[model samples]
Target: MSPASSDAQWYEAKVPPPLLGLAGLFLQHRLAPAGGGSWPRRAAGLGLSGGAVALMGSAAGTFRRRGTTVDPLHPDRAEQLVTDGPFARTRNPMYLGMAAVLAAHAVARGGVLTWLPVAGFVAAIDRIQVPPEERALHRVFGQDYADYTRTVRRWV
Candidate 1:
């Protein structure tokens, strides 16, 4: 199998995004010490959490309207290449939203150490989850996908 296909199979076989985020949260809880300096403000955390919710919701809604699958593990199942809504801002709005949520939670919990898991979550999505989906999109959509990638940032 090609590397993209292998990655797609691997991602499909592994735990879903929400579960991965939860695992990262669990890790943060265990790894971070009880007390530390707070780098993010409470208002900022709340704002980020709200923005995450909005972004994810908008992206999902757009997918539904466009009749495309939102599940990244099943990129082959996508029927359309949605570029409007939250997608216009970021190629992987769902993952970006998830990262935002993670960051918000870490900030709300109040510890610089908590940011470690947020970073890990972002890295995992960027390195692991996104590649296969990108490949699938390219295979399915060709130059259209490439154009979309060029115009939109992966994460914003």
Candidate 2:
């Protein structure tokens, strides 16, 4: 989702590529040695991505069941107002979880080359994906949703 407003207004800074670069290196090399042991590490990445998909899918399902629509591009739909499970801690826990998995992939095998792409991915999501969702929510939920926004963070 796109960021409706500049994150720079609230955040002090963005993450540098180097840190993300390291995640890539791990993704590519599967760091912690690579000659023999591999199954557990590989499973970890799969698990991260898989589990996140499930959780986010569940969130989507909840919205669907409630007769609400969820946009892949925004955080605005919640006809029943789900605030449980992964959602309780992070306002956009699904996205946060998915990002963690992607970052893990970078770490699992991306190395230095993965940094720029990862940063760009996050930026695009912030600028293009999140705003419409927020805007849609502003229309659907109105004041009650706005109040929730005041208490919860957009992302953790």
Instruction: Provide the overall lDDT of each model, using Cα atoms, as 2-decimal numbers.
Output: 0.84, 0.56
Error of 1 at 17 (Å): 1.3
The residue pairs that clash in candidate 1, if any, are: none
Task: Look at candidate 2 and tell me the lDDT of residue 43.
Answer: 69
Model 1 alpha-carbon drift over 4 Å, by segment: 1-8, 31-40
Model 2 misplaced stretches (Cα beyond 4 Å): 1-41, 73-78
Model 2 per-residue lDDT at 57? 76
- Model 2 C-alpha RMSD vs. true structure (Å) is 8.2
Best by TM-score: 1
Over the stretch 1-156, how does candidate 1's per-residue lDDT look in tens digits? 887667667766977888888888787777665753255566777888998989889999999999999887788778999999889888988888888888887777776778998999999888877887888888889999999999999987
- Reference-based TM-score, model 1: 0.87
Count steric clashes of candidate 2. Answer: 24
